[model samples]
Target: GAGVSQSPRYKVAKRGQDVALRCDPISGHVSLFWYQQALGQGPEFLTYFQNEAQLDKSGLPSDRFFAERPEGSVSTLKIQRTQQEDSAVYLCASSLALGGEMAGYTFGSGTRLTVV
Candidate 1:
């Protein structure tokens, strides 16, 4: 089992540039979620998918932030027109399913996106 993994661990981008971060969830998991964490703040939900269907995205900060789980396992979060405010850690998590208390969500170390 790969747990959950994110690539680049860190990223530096110029303002207005676009960036894409990647995530790989644990095998057999049925739910995936993306979150953003600012310094000293808790993770804020960005979007979620059950299998290949995006079930929720209400927490996406803006239209520039987009996420997708194309094949129900690997996911990507793409930010268009990066801004300084977008500097933060992007986290990915997965669970057996998006039900109940979500107590089994496993999180990755995250990709730290820094926009300058």
Candidate 2:
């Protein structure tokens, strides 16, 4: 894919159900980031991975949320026991390298998750 790709563009989860979102970044990209965007708010960084190694996860809101990129290509974000407060869009972004080109990041269309 030419740009970052996310699956299930929209999802409606029943309260307490677990959900998994997928992100497929551009091929060979070294840096991948996951962010959460509440309605009408800017995206907030959730975690960062550089080539299969998770370098930062400080932005993850709670233990119930987990993200991983085991092969440095595809990543998955899993949220457990979905709650109404958790409803938001999950964004995935990728860059060619760490702090490369200064063009910032290429963000995917994002997966909008709704909890009811």
Please write out the lDDT profile of model 1 over residues 1-116, one tens digit for every residue: 66899998999999999999999999989899999999999999999999999999999989998998889999999999999999999999989855625567999999998998
How many Å off is the CA of 86 in candidate 1? 0.4
Worst 10 residues of 2 by lDDT: 97-106
Error of 1 at 59 (Å): 0.5
Runs in model 1 deviating more than 4 A are 100-103
Note the residue pairs that clash in candidate 1: none
Once superposed on the true structure, which residue ranges of model 2 sit more than 4 Å away at CA? Answer: 100-102
User: Which TM-score value belongs to model 2?
Assistant: 0.96
Backbone Cα, N, C clashes tallied per candidate? 0, 0
